[model samples]
Target: MRRIGFLGCGKIGKALVRHIAEREDMAVEFIQDPGFINDIGVQCPVLAKADEAAFAGADLIVECATAQVLSENLELILAHCDLMMFSVTAFGDPDFERRAKALCGTYGRTIFIPHGAILGLDGIFDGGPVWRQVTVETVKSPSSLGRQDNRRSVVYEGPTREACVHFPRNVNVHAAVALAGIGFDRTISRIISDPEVSTNAHRISLSGDGISITLDISSYAAGAVTGAYTPYSACGSLDRALGNGAGLRFV
Candidate 1:
């Protein structure tokens, strides 16, 4: 059984913990979430905020925590084992992104960025150097955006970096798009909170010298901030990252 460590046990993390609880192929080593509760039947050690040293026992540590947590323990996590990142928005900071990649080299550890709550990430990544411009326009229910607005409103608009700063939890897909396509500074991010939309929607537009492509992805909400499909995405990412060898990787 693969020993797995979880950095957070929020909605998505809890869902994944339950999903793999009974699996014969994996075991939960420990969990480090301040807000974690054992509502489900599965049992594991709930680590404190300062006990990251326990991570050395994990084959792969899944980070379902916030960008801030990831940033704080970047080197420590990489020193222990491979990491599957849910908070891709943390890379919105060019310095952090660069440092993370460098540490992956230093520690011979891998950082896996998951395709969360969206599709067509492969094509976006394949565009690579040819990508001159890229934009991710996301729409979420007003409640999802932490607002009570009854009508549609553009909550944020700017470079992907700034957008991630403004709406870290909500517009992570845009940050993923930026990483896969052009870059944080070049990629455009537009976030809309609309009561009319029944799903969390992301529309990606890629423009290059001779190519123009658009992709639209949508998912229902399981919570105000968690997408119904996100937990499954995390599971899939974990499966793919199980035995990865060194360096930065996208799952």
Candidate 2:
């Protein structure tokens, strides 16, 4: 069985553990969460520290924690095992991405980025040497916006790199689009807060090589918290990763 280590025990990490536990080919061996060590119980090894020993026997480490956790634990994780990061938005930091890539090369391991909450990637990659333009509009209820309540508003619009830097918490979708199409600087993103919309919506459009594609997806809040649907969609990407010839490609 393929041994896996998880770097967070939040909704997505818990979902991944549940998913892997049911699979015949993979088993979660280690779980790390600073916030909730006892929540998952003895079903798996739980650790408070991020270190090679914590990840000792795992074949792969999945990071579903915040970008801060990722930035701090990354070197240790990469040193011990191959890594799959759900927080791809952190890569928008050019310095961090460059250093991480170099470290991965030095450690002779691979880093995988899940699609998370973006679409039309296959089409974008299919058309190589392509130029991509994207606009991301998010519609969420006032409660979903947290403490500050606005009736409806456009919060941000700019290059994906800047958006990722300014809104690290919301970078997954934008980062996914940026990595899949052009680099972060080339991808356009817009964030909107709409009280009228009950669900989260993502719309993507790409035109290149005589092909134009558009994808619009709306997902209801799966759990009590906001941003629940993104991780559920990320689960789909994980499924694709484990399937043969099922990996996503533009072509």
Candidate 1 clash total? 0
- Residue 194 lDDT, candidate 1, scale 0-100: 90
What's the lDDT for candidate 2? 0.72
Deviation in angstroms for 214 in model 2?
1.4
Give the per-residue lDDT of model 2 (tens digit) for 94-147.
887997999999999888777665555665555546654655655555555452
The ten-residue window of minimal lDDT in model 2 covers: 242-251
| Regions of model 2 farther than 4 Å from truth | 37-42, 142-147, 222-233, 239-251
> Which residue pairs show backbone clashes in model 2?
122-250, 126-250
Per TM-score, the best of the predicted structures is 1
Off by over 4 Å in 1: 243-251
True-structure lDDT of candidate 1: 0.83
